[model samples]
Target: MASSNSLLSEMQFLCPICLDVFTRPVSTPCGHNFCMSCITCYWNDTPVCQCPICKETFEKRPDLKVNTFISELASQFMSLQVTDAHIWSADQQKASCGGAVLCDICTNTKQEAVKSCLECQTSYCDVHLEPHHRATGLKRHTLVDPLASLENMICKEHTRLLMLFCKNDQVLLCDVCAISRHVNHDVISMQQAYKEMKALLGDTEAKVQQMIQERLQKVQAMNESVKQSVTETKDVIANGVQDLTTLVSEIQKSQKELVKVMEEKQKEAEEQADEFISGMKQEITELQKTMMKLRELKQTEDQLCFLQSFPNSSLLPHTMDLSTFSFNRHAEIQHIRKSLSKSVSELKMLLNKMNTEIQKFSDDTDVSNNTMLRYMQQFEVDIVLDPDTAHPLLTLSDDGKQVKYSMGSGLWGIQNLNPNMFTEHLAVLGQRGFSSCRFYFEVFVGGKTEWCLGVATASVQRRGALVRGPGCGLWAIWFLEDKFETFSSPNVPVHFGKPERIGVFVDYNGGQIYFYDRQTATLIYCFTECFFTEELYPYFNPCDNEYGSNLDPLIIVPVSRME
Candidate 1:
């Protein structure tokens, strides 16, 4: 029996279909043996009956017959190996009892699986997994954790394990897929792709955090601005209320003064009436006594006394002559009325002056236009001449800081005008142009008899007679002869004195241009609500030189700091 068991162990009695000892062994016409049920099932699943091991074909269906001799041999082999198989199974169960994945091969007692083989797409217990670790054929199979869903890790189209990443398609690919459909695509190892994607995710996370911080900062700044705006609004309201209160108090004081004067005039008139009534009453009392004495003398008992009293009528009160008691009310009140009228006129003058002052206060804070210009001087710009835009007759200094008209020698010396020159106007534009900010420049017109200086938009005509007015995109003031004038629609005259150094301020955002006398800090003129759409340049015209009368150059002056 020992000799038979040793021979059976060396013999090949395992079926290729089940990889185990064959049960109910059968033989076909091709002379290959297999389990009867396994052969039938294989043939039924295929188009033709063929041997699985040798690839031998059968032309016709052949009746299967049990190979009794091989069956007995396989039964004896299984019985002999039973003790060793039981021992191996027991060892595998003991080794894998703690794991979650149960081995598929351990039928009698299910045990935990140690590793999953990608090539077989099956999980195996430690005992069954020994083939992958020891055998050369199974050693090359990929192993991983005992995964629950091995199907998810497989390529459905190729029915192969996914082991690569296709960068072109941004998808996971199997080895066969990478070689076939994705051969020309960018592909990388799965591990390498995973590391790169993790790095990218970390970078993205950092950027998102930075963006969050930036937005939070913006929110905080906006909140602060809102708070500041509210605070400023409250302060403005409080100041305005205080000013109005002061004005009201002034009006109340004027009213009291007016009432006091009127009351004094009325009291004087009442005192005059009271004095007239008292004089009339004293005269009446004297007349009543004279009449009582006259009646006593008329009784004839005192005829002599009556004659004596009548004889001295001039000595008694003159009852018939009431001229001394007459009240000239108009004469009494005329002086008071005249005084009240004068007081009213003076009060009206005071109110008028106050109204004018209040109007001035309402229009602008204590700061005058000159003060505003001084404030704007902080944004003063250094202006230079642009020779390209100057008229042919105009000569520019080497430093481009001054320009003056120069007529070439003859009485009517006509110089050839270039296309870039201002043909009809003796105008030159500054080198720098501004479109959206505040800028100021000063031009010295000290000895020039006639000159024009201000800002002009880029669209102003360069070759023809350019209208120096707001409608033509030119906001300017001019000094001609002895008069100062602003080039408005109708050329309004400016009453301000001539300024040797004229400061031109342009506020593009505010749409205004202000002219100032830098020497006296006085405003010459201002062009308000100016519609500026393009770049603005400082415009200067010395007005044809005037036969040496206006020969002085228009010099661009530097702004000086205030003390």
Candidate 2:
């Protein structure tokens, strides 16, 4: 029966190519072995090389990496000296005799010392050794037994037998080795080669394991850096978005002013054209009527006899009066002409001023906001500017009343546009607060609703509102369909009572408007966050336009029959 070591030796240690031992060996995908450089040289010469085991053609040679650990293990196993198990057992029983010398032939175990000679196959006490040496001067008597003698044998070029042990040769070579091919090369006996290689095995294994462990740690560190880079990419995109929003606000403001200037100037120009055209039309109509009457008098029967009697002198005077015509222009027309000219000149001047103002706003579009809220961005939001250690973000207000019309905290929520489309929100930062608490706002877009997250947020102020401020929380509304409740309080910003003010407008955009606590800039729970602004009824519009009376958010929910 083959031992496990012998089976493993055949499986992993032996290289199929060469077969003597694995030397600089490498394994293929088909589990066949070849020397590293041997395979590369083979494939480089041959365009496609087929694997020996599977006959699978490989288009390219893989990288040549050393399998040094397994190769070293193979070399160590080939050099050991050992014995047959059954012979060792029999020898052990014979060696038990007292005063008998143990054979130095096979095993490393102990027995009584005996003077043993292998050629005679005789074991003798040290006193009996003198008789055999004097007889015939025997030449073939090996002093040592078979086990130790096996190490001394060498190969000869002529006989090629295990004989002629070479003292200078280091390796067991065939009889051909001592020919001219090895004329000057130094060599030693087979015993010397085995001794040297066996001693180096322990040190080789330690070095291989240390190298593999170090490389694996390097691969792991590289993967962690890849994950960190993904986080940084997200931060850059979020900052870009905030910058775009600010730019859009400035653009809308400049556009509104431009439209106002153009409309005023256009109206004045049209008025001037209409007044000049109307007076010219009246004079042209009167001249046509006078020419028609003169034709009637010349053709009439009553005037025909008088025309014949008057002769050439009367006809000349009539024709003369017809050719010459004039009128005194009223001061009203003159005054209108002067007034219209002045109006146009003023309109042109206003247009020039507007163009300059627009350029100023456009140039400031890239204004940078360094004051950012630092925090890890949640799923809904994109950018988080949270520092390692900063005070908890204050989203709440003290007394939780940031919506007190124009009275409390000096916060007057004014619309920048007609519908307040372009508006800014301010928040009174709250104190140390729980993470779950959030802000609420009521919107009135045709009806009452809420603002979306991130779309509505606190003002730029980071400090908690201990003193009177913009009250920290501001929800700008168009109040187009609805209106703002008009009322004021001295220090308290929020209207504590029922929503009763001049205009009651709800923020309605399907969004969340966070009215933070002014004291610490932290969001208040249920006290100040309002969702439905329609609760403040009897709403009055803020704009002074005649159509302001039509302030009613048109809300309609048409229902279908349920199946």
Instruction: Say which candidate scores most in TM-score.
Output: 1
Stretches of candidate 2 above 4 Å error? 1-183, 188-228, 239-283, 286-563
Model 2 lowest lDDT segment of ten: 368-377
Q: What does candidate 2's lDDT look like per residue over 159-250, in tens digits?
A: 24342124455445544665545566655555665565566665666677776666665566556657776777677558756866775686
Error of 2 at 492 (Å): 81
By lDDT, the best candidate is 1
Indicate the residue-level lDDT of 507 in model 1.
87
CA lDDT for candidate 2: 0.39
Estimate the TM-score of every prediction: 0.35, 0.23
Compared with the true structure, all predictions reach lDDT values of 0.78, 0.39
Model 1, 1-563: lDDT tens digits are 34666755635687778767788999877677888888889999899778887888888867888899998888877776786678888888876674477787798998888888777878899999998889998998888888656777877887677889999999999988888888888999999999999999999999999999978877986798699979988997799789878978987897897688768977887897887778779888998887786676677557666666564446467544555555566785688679767977997897798677556545753346645766788898888878778777878777888877776433323345566667788888888899899998888888677888888778788776766545787788777766678765445677546568888888898777888777776777787647788999889998875645776788888887532
